[model samples]
Target chain A: MKIAEIVKTLDGSVILGKENLEKDVEMGFASDLMSDVLTLQTSNILLITGLSNVQTIRTAEMADITCIVMVRNKKVTSEIIDLANENNIVIIECCYSMFKTCGLLFQAGLKPVY
Target chain B: MHFQYSIEGGDFSRAGNASSQLKKLLKQLNVDSQLIKRIVVALYEGEVNIVAHAHRGTIDVDIEPDKVFIRLSDEGPGIPDIKQAMKEGYSTASQKVREMGFGAGMGLPNMLKNADKLNIESEPGKGTIVELTTLLR
Candidate 1:
């Protein structure tokens, strides 16, 4: 699915990389652990994580995840946004819990990386 | 080409900078995307390991026509038993590190899975050294 549709489905606001709204992401991986993310070995993944920090952005960059959906309405700092922009990673903020975010995206045709 | 980066222990904010830069270098050299992915993942895990466990460390990356080699050497409380440290669910990371979404004890295992070769050397009081090699072919 294109990222824009995902924003609508989850009532998520684009916090960065709006220019990438049309990018296609087919798989989703929900994890707060960066190591689990590195193990994915896939690209164009939508990382559903509640861990909002520089570390999260770093994980996405190394793992080549396309976008990050921050669950639980976590606030993103400027450092995180700057790094995400540098890495060309899109960030979306949502108030839904991680489970709900994943379920909603899964229902919308996003495949699980597993 | 050879590259070097330094990692500061407990500096979670800057942990993956080395990996990111090495990734860009590999891309500029037109390394295969799959190989680059593996190399980057392994290096990033090593970088994070230093940040989470060591006092400080240095990363040396040597890229050849057919391979990439990385060596990380850190000065801190080294692992007394590398076998235990390499176990999938064993970690000595503190709660602060855990709060950053790391410290799951998966770093070394991920590095091993992604890198073609992995070597670890540690001294209980001195430090640890992790070396990873990935063949481009």
Candidate 2:
């Protein structure tokens, strides 16, 4: 699925890297733990997390995650956005909780890789 | 290319600066993305451990043509049980560290996973040294 589609589905705002919205994503991983995301490697993955911190961006960069979806109405700080922009990562803020965001995306065909 | 960074404890905001700079350096060197990712993950976790657990420490990164070596040395309350600390979901970090989205007890295991080789030596109540290496190929 294209990130543009995911944004439309979630009615999310692109806080950064909006031009890369058309990038393709194969799967989604929802976790706040950075190590979990690192251990479970997947290509072209979108990471959904509630924890908004520098480590979140660092984890995304380490795993080469295409985009990050901040659920539970978490605000992406300037530092986070700056880091994301530097790493060429796309950020999306969604009002839906983590579960609902993942559910909607999964129902929309972006299944998790177990 | 080689790099060295001093990590100060209790500074959550500056925790991953070393990893960030190394990531940029690796990219500029045109290192393989996979290899770079492994090196970054391992280095970042190690750096965070120093800042969270130790009073202070230093990270030495040796970037070679075929491998990257990262050594972290810290002066703090050393691990009494290396085997237990190596286990996932086991941590000695305080509650304040846990609230920062870290201290999930996954730091050591995650570092091991990312590095091709890991060597840990610690003296309880003295200090600890962790060395990690990742092969480019």
> Using lDDT as the measure, which candidate wins?
1
Every model: iRMSD:
0.9, 1.5
Please give the C-alpha DockQ score of model 1. 0.89
Candidate 2 TM-score to native: 0.95
Off by over 4 Å in 1: none
lDDT (10s digit) by residue, model 2, range A1-114 = 999999999999999988998889989999877767777656569999998998788778777887999999999889989888988999999999998999899999997868
DockQ of 2: 0.60
**Candidate 2 per-residue C-alpha lDDT over B52-123 given as tens digits, one digit per residue, 9 for 90 to 100:** 999999999998878888999999898999999999999888876776667888999998888899999999
Q: What is the TM-score of chain B alone in each candidate?
A: 0.98, 0.97
Instruction: Tell me the docking grade of candidate 1.
Output: high
For all candidates in order, the CA lDDT equals 0.91, 0.87
